[model samples]
Target: MRILCIGDVTSPKGVEHLRQNLWRVRKENGIDFCIVNAENAALITGASVNDAETLLSSGADCLTGGNHTLRNRSVYTYLDDSEYMLRPINFGEGTPGHGYTVLDCNGYKIMVINAMGNINIEPVLDSPYSYIDRVLEREAGKYDFAVLDIHAEATGEKAAIGYAYDGKISVIFGTHTHVPTCDEIILPRGTGYISDIGMCGESGGVLGMNPELVVKAQRSRMPIRFEAASGAPRATGVIFELNESTGKVTSIKRIAF
Candidate 1:
């Protein structure tokens, strides 16, 4: 099975770019399933209902989220209603949406999990370790393969989690930092891992935000509203090829264009 995991979408431009190009990427790559992190798909914060819908229609089989997912109240309902749109699993009970989902496709049951790191993040949640442990235990024997999207700010934390679940999960990709890492490898246990997949927005901006605005805010030591950089956007991510019999990744490839 070939799964394509996309990075964070930082703005409407990013969303539009995906709408225009993602289908072709999936087709050319022979993607069996596609996951996209879209917490920042709005102008500067959480994805709206329309943004989520646009991405889903454009080719994203499932959508994962991060810290900014709840920034917009308007999407709360959609998050609850959509079976494949997820927030952090450790967000606890009563959260708008779920953190994991099992999709039945191509004669296989694929489980996708979304979790957030506790380090250097707000509203400190439960340990990602414990939450994922519980989910895997509870869902054992129900799914054929599992993939994780760890929305985290710390590379070390992401790497630790990836190693911890190396043999258990088929693929583990990090998000939230919006900068693609060069390190993409299949662990000794056969799990595919990457520190980050990068963002789908202006390639020249500061993590997708207008560089000048970010600089002004930092230099002036004041809160300045950051806007998405205006220009052509690029999509960045990784594709993992898994062996159906072993439920382990056979290879990993980075994609950026």
Candidate 2:
């Protein structure tokens, strides 16, 4: 089975870009299932209900979130009701949405987990290592394969999780950094791993935001509302081919444009 996981979508243009191209990308790549990180899809901060609906209708089989996911409170209800939308699992109790979901792909159950690393991240919650252990144990025998999107800043933290869960998960990919790493590889234990899958947004800016605005904020140390860049948007992600019976990744390939 083949699965594709996309990085964060920064703005409306990023969402539109996916609306226009994702279906074709899926078709051309023969992707069986797709997961997209869209916490920033509404604007530059948080996604709204419309953004979620648009991404779902466009092509994503599931949507994942990061630290900025709940910034817009408008999506709370949809997050609870939608079986395919996820928030960081370690957000602790009483959070709006779930951190993981089990998607039925034909007869196979694919479990998708979203987790955040605490280092230099806000509202720090449970340790991803411990929370994931609890989750894996609680959900045991419930899924045929597992995949995790570790939303984090530090590359070391992402790498640690990848190594810790190498044999336990089918794929482990990092997000939130918005910069693609060329180190896509099949781990020693067969899990497909990448430090970061990059992002889907305007390409000619600083992490999808307007460069000028970002520079202004940095230079002035003031509260500046950065806007999405106007350059052509592109989608970046990685595809994992897993052995159906073993649930181990057979190959990993990075995709962009």
Q: RMSD, each candidate, Å?
A: 1.0, 0.9
- Per-residue lDDT over 1-257 for candidate 1, one digit per residue giving the tens place of the 0 to 100 score: 99999999999989999999999999999999999999999966799999999999999999999999989899999888888799989997888888999998699999999999999987688889999999999999999999999999899999999999999999999999999998998999999999999999877789998899999999999999998887679999999999999998999999997
Each candidate's number of clashing pairs is 0, 0
- Per-model lDDT: 0.93, 0.92
Off by over 4 Å in 2: none
Candidate 2 residue-wise lDDT, 1-257, digit = tens:
99999999999999999999999999999999999999889875688888888999999999999999999898999889988999999997889989999999978999999999998878686789988998899999999999999999989999999999998999999999899898888888899999999999998899998999999999999999989888899999999999999888999999997
Assess candidate 2 and give its lDDT. 0.92
- TM-score of each model, in listed order: 0.98, 0.98
